[model samples]
Target: MYQASKQRYETMPYRHVGQSGLRLPAISLGLWHNFGDVDRLSNQKEILCGAFDRGVTHFDLANNYGPPAGSAERNFGRILREELGQYRDELVISSKAGYYMWPGPYGEWGSKKNIIASCDQSLQRMGLDYVDIFYHHRPDPDTPIEETAGALDLLVRQGKALYIGVSNYSAEQTVAIAKVFKKLGTPFIIHQPRYNMFDRWIEDGLTDVLTQENLGAITFSPLAQGLLTNRYLNGIPADSRAGRSSSPFLSPENVEATINKVQQLNQIAQNRGQSLAEMALAWNLRQPTVTSVLVGASRLSQLEDSLKALNHLDFAAEELAQIDAIVGK
Candidate 1:
């Protein structure tokens, strides 16, 4: 039996979700890459257990996260039943649905049909009565915003989800949908966006609206898919995600210019006695609107190393200037 340490909560700080009563850990785990169908189930379970042991109670997932789609949830469902069943209430399990999922229509986007069906399919896969937080995977251009918001409202009223969130939405879209949620009395709790040292699109306008609306923001890819880490300082190793994986988001072309920027950031991190990955995560958490920094690690040690960012978050003015020079606005 796996026994979680009672002291786990004391080591990592929790931030309240935008004006809500729910609090999320400073660092959350994402099952986007590693936890999939082709991977070893035991290894995935080990990583999940290790994260919980170290105070990562929030695990982010999506309906289309796996290579086969829904495999991540199926795998996590096994863990929930076999290992995490006793600690269900203490964990924050979240799933999203907006991207391409199943074949044919009604499988993607934020329509009422897609949202309701996706949540039902997610609940079935996870073998849970309800998820703590459910999110619209992305905004729909064709679907009416009110319909999408209504689906989320229905989920909460039906006891399928405790809270609702949206991902990859611009400030205007968020504000518009938030109004519908407010009118319907549904809790628009959080917004997930791609944010990191190299990417600040949310800061362009989304952060301001989220602050005003009192909605928490939890950013994904806080390390820029490992570009913010020391793994790419010299050259991409064969096992590195950027080297081995064929993700368009982290292609070799993208790394060409980023190599120098990463090295310079590493120097600043070294001066602060932290790793580049640590600083990257800390940078996101430094934002008051940021509720959690969602991270994914291929190994347990990487997760452990990433958590060290919590030890020293204060940055000197010169250090910030140095970072700005490398990643100027």
Candidate 2:
């Protein structure tokens, strides 16, 4: 019953993932939060619809994305069935394996058994025959890289996934697995890293490797888990994620440590006629190796604000310098 915007593609930019034939929107939606079972399905549907109508063709997910695990995929499945099912071909839906999803040993890691079973479970939860792209959520220190690459290759061969990717991999780990994927002739296309103004771990070496290997990079947490946003500019609001006592990742101490830098960066964003979140996203996409920026939004308005980053993607040399200085680069 929902109609996507006829002009959806008009304002959005698509970039090729490294040298791959596949392309992703300049900004992709990530269902990392607020799409789980504890959240309202109606709100989830609205965000999905809003994103699609705004030309967000890619939706990133993982088996462990929900608090209860698998709930995000289930909710997305229902939305896909009820609303966006007709536009399946026009969208690029991705899901990840790795990370614990069940009670036993088989529920986690890079074993062929875990990866294969997880992908199947994710497909079932999302009610899909195939996902556009599938990722191994993180590195397994004990598992042989060959075993994991083989599992992904097997998925592509079985038609369960069109392409394969890895997340949270280091530059060295990426190179190692990319070799295996190359030998297997797997369509290993992209790497997802946590990158933002504050987090520069990828720049330490990963970006160069991605460019050299011709693999695309999609940086998640482009807003640094909302640290780079205006949400904490005036101190943490009780309703915000960092303010919530339940959140272990973003604590008040964490905000206090970074608030000074955030405020300084905010002034630069205002001078550029954009919001801090917008500037943060633009900054990540400034790297050519970065094929896209993955952002998560809990509300339609937040998604709209993120989309506005595309409007002013250019940064003067001085602006970059100032940003680097403020964030202690």
Candidate 3:
């Protein structure tokens, strides 16, 4: 009997996905890091429930999000059933395929077999009849774009997914698949790419094409795996992700290489009356094509700190330029 706060929607802002009637919260929760079987269920409940209580209507997931590969969704399914079952319709749940989940040729990528089977597996793990948005986790070099995009469209037709999206796709790849999706009459809406102060590859060409193609984007790694935040300002802590996490995404050398820029950014964030993490989150949302920023938290405090980014999403011309100079953009 956990009652959500009545004011959950009071402070959170929702942005419209590109050219679509659907909207997502400005800051959505991502289950990429925590929420696996190795993590505590009670803590997971606290974070998920806490997010919903504060109006994080979107929760991003993928088939390979867990250490054991499907555990995140399985744990999420339990949370949904035991804690938030009554509020299902109030949430925007999304999952992705295209990553290696099981052995064999059909275990990964964007082939129709992989896509459809992965979706069914994901749905079964999460105990859901349908997901609001389903994505191809990444582009497949060998698989034909038409086959991948067509499989996604088929999901919508089969009532397994509502909208379609693609992640980790370069600008050209996005355009190619988008063209096929248009012809198939798919409700292709969003792109999930890595964007942050330390990583601005999206600005290279993706943002422009997102506008041209009328697709929204939800940026992941917006904190640069916690680099943009104050977490590394004093050097990497022993308990931080870079310190000991099995995830090879971030390393100690990576933190050391970027500490100077991070410190400089922190000073600028302090000047703006916001933390570095807040400014980083706001920076991603600065793009009109960006509909939301996907963030992850291992603790309630971290999640709370991230949510405060909404308090000041605006940045001045000088502030933006200073950030660009610091991060070498």
lDDT of 1 by residue, 133-213 (tens): 999988999999999999999999999999999999999999999999989999889999999989999988999999999
Model 2, runs deviating above 4 Å:
none
Would you estimate the TM-scores of all the predictions? 0.97, 0.98, 0.97
- The residue pairs that clash in candidate 3, if any, are none
Greater-lDDT candidate between 1 and 2: 2
Query: Which candidate has the top score in TM-score?
Result: 2
The local distance difference test score of each candidate is: 0.90, 0.93, 0.93
Model 2 residue 63 distance off true place after TM-score fit, in angstroms: 0.6
Q: What TM-score should be assigned to candidate 2?
A: 0.98
As for candidate 2, its clashing pairs are none
Clash totals for all candidate models: 0, 0, 0
Could you tell me which 10 consecutive residues in candidate 1 have the lowest summed lDDT? 239-248
